[model samples]
Target: MLLSLPNWIIHLSSALEWGIAAALLFHYGKITGRRDIRLFGLAMLPHWSGSFFVLGYHISGDTIPILLDMSELINLFGSTALLLATLNLLKSTKKTSATSYTAALAAIMIAGKPQSYLGADIFDAILQLSSVVYITFLVLLLKVWRRDRTIFSGLTVAGFWFVLIFISVTIFCMYLATVVRGYPTLSHDDLLHGLAESLLSISNLMIAIGAHRKIREYKREQLNAIQG
Candidate 1:
């Protein structure tokens, strides 16, 4: 089966995103006096790691003995990291306490095999709930931006765009996977999955860039203040 343009684009984009993310982390370190941004960067690491795992599975055609056993472990850890990152970001603004609690609950629900026994409906519900939480966080961030536009301007812009892309793609894919499952056929599955992955990769890159830029701006401001 030949890969479509979108799939190819996303694949290449993901590979590049990893590099961009690394650079952004370095820049973030330079700007922020706090080391906590490292946590955010670490949270994003699993997405790329999962990408590699899937890629390896596709290429090998045979499941790795250890990986098969560890798949659930990987998923749980990765999902938890993502959820924590989302919560941490919200916490930064000191808003959305309810959303943070909901996110935490959802993460706990996902820790076990709820999806395996409850089926797609349950999984979809969790995902939808998460989507709402993230959306709310996005709104809160925008409100913050309105108040103090320069506080974390670069990071905020990048984070907003990244979250927007993520939420858009996630909702679309969830709908397709649930409502339109049979219409497009199986071939479309691979293409959609690849496209979704690519979008997430781009989102991560944008966030990293934004965070890096914010850090630089913060440092410049601090330096100027010190001199004055």
Candidate 2:
């Protein structure tokens, strides 16, 4: 394996936490009778599958480029799914301006990618596009929270945004490990790699815990209403 045991644990735990968060959100939607929320939960599965592709890449000692490519492709779909689901959640409200803002932001972000579209490879372009979509999703997620705080806990929303932090740190560590330290890849420098990945674990943990809290709160409200 390309990763150490501790790194493996971090990856596995991040995936597990994401899966649990999705399941909890699904259940919360079911109990609360919110179809949009259920769809949002379902939307998370593509990214979870993408994570497994990443794990497979690592398991192969990072030799399989195809696995990494597939991960990026699937993640793009995942980001789109999340964005659409969030828009659905806002269907009852007027968010034309907000949606327009996100659209313009997405365009700007995509245009602002480091390289020109003609110069970048397909996968690189896909990754950039996915980042833009994910950022748009994050922005809309905050809008959803402001519109309906009852839909998701503040912590849950924060966890989703925390992924940006993980990405930034990973990029910096990759430069330090590969460029500065002459390592082949960030994963080759276990310490920095682990440090960057641990942030992902923390974010996933927050998502799961926040979703669980929301579920419990909803269940309690139902129980109290029934008892009363």
Top-TM-score candidate index: 2
* Model 1 clashing residue pairs (backbone): none
Give all candidates' CA lDDT scores.
Answer: 0.56, 0.89
Off by over 4 Å in 2: 94-115
Mind giving the per-residue lDDT tens digits that candidate 1 earns over 110-183? 76445444435444444444444445445544554554454345554565457567657866886785568853
Model 2 per-residue lDDT at 79:
96
> What overall lDDT, based on C-alpha atoms, would model 1 receive against the true structure?
0.56
Q: Write the per-residue lDDT of candidate 2 for residues 75-164, one digit (tens) a residue.
A: 999998998888888774565554675577668776786466423479988897888789988988998899888899999999999999
Let me know the TM-score candidate 1 reaches against the reference structure.
0.56
Model 1, runs deviating above 4 Å: 4-6, 57-76, 85-117, 120-198
* Candidate 2 weakest lDDT stretch, 10 residues: 111-120
